[model samples]
Target: MTLPIDPTALAGLVSRQIRTGERQGMPTKIAIAERTYATDPDDLWNALTDAGRIPRWFLPISGDLSVGGRYQLEGNAGGVVEECEPPKRFAVTWEMGPMISWLEVRLDPAAEGTTLELVHEAPVDPDMWKQFGPGAVGVGWDLGLMGLGLHLDSGAAVDPATALEFPTSPEGMMFVRTAATGWADAAIADGDDPALARPAAEATLAFYTVIPEEGTQS
Candidate 1:
């Protein structure tokens, strides 16, 4: 199926930021992304948290799905459900292999539709952040949000294989480039050097869109 995505409109809908708050003993940076969905809060929340319906747009999810429960998104992060309140908000501990982070999603009614806010907080890893900036996580969410939009707009399931191949497609590359640039803008807004942020954004774009040479793999 053709990926029905509006890159320009989707780019306009996203807002990003790098927020700092104390986590353990020092300051931690959280990558925050927000966008509005035309659907209502109830519908949006169902699309997000309902395991049965998730694989249609996003990944297949298997989980206990309640406060203090555990969840796994196929081939993605698995985490503990830290908090949950239907149609409003949910918080979880994002655990991937040995790394841990915190994730919170909030939903609210908006003038045009519903506002969805996602916060991914992790202890500052200066080395990685310096090399990639927020685009690393921001672009991933951009894809997920775009998937949600397409699913809601068309009321159809996105073939999982197509979703996996999207980034390598021309339109998908354009979408990711726009998203990575948007993240760079957000980082600049938060006082990161434009010189640094722009390059980091480009690095992120390369990571997501470029195919490695066939002979490079050992």
Candidate 2:
């Protein structure tokens, strides 16, 4: 299945690569994505901070959501809440086995809506990032934002799996295909070698294929 690509949407968001020194001579690198929603910052904050709303779009998150509080995601990763500022910003440790990363989300108000920014930093194996590229998190976040849009605009509860599955539908495939191309473009813009970006995009598309194009595979 190929998905339609929204180059403008992908390009509008800001993504940064961070390098942190904590592992001997190796450097930790991360990529961030930022976007604005047509909703108030407070509303956006509730959607993220409210545990009940999390599973509707993103993962099933369980945590105190306060500074220094620990949290967990069902069947996924878990870690400690590093920082929290209601209606503004929050940070947490994202742990999956040996990989420990930090994810920070910030919210701000705008004339049209609310601005949402996400930053994820960790010591990634260079080869892994080369294979996954931005789509590793980009696709997931896209689904999350789509759900947020539904909730804010129409009070709809989007099934997380369905949101992810949409990209495999005949129409959805077009979106995924286009999205893959967009990710490739973003990677290139972020200074990834063309040679690396193309393959990385391909790998990301392949990862999504774990669910069959017909939406039967789990």
Best by TM-score: 1
Clashes of each: 0, 11
Quote the RMSD, in angstroms, for model 2.
3.9
> Worst ten-residue run, lDDT, model 2?
1-10
Among the numbered candidates, top lDDT falls to 1
Candidate 1 wrongly placed segments (more than 4 Å): 212-218
Assess every candidate by TM-score.
0.93, 0.81
Runs in model 2 deviating more than 4 A are 1-25, 213-217
lDDT of each: 0.86, 0.69
Question: Mind giving the per-residue lDDT tens digits that candidate 1 earns over 47-132?
Answer: 99989888889998997998988999998999999889999999999888998889999999999899999998887778888999
Model 2 residue 186 CA deviation (Å) reads 2.8
Question: Taking the tens digit of each residue's C-alpha lDDT, what string does model 2 give over 1-218?
Answer: 12224533433443434333454455665556667788888889989889998776667888676778888888788999888889899998889988787788989898889988887767757777788877776665655565566566666677655666666565555444555656677667757788987888778777765555564746
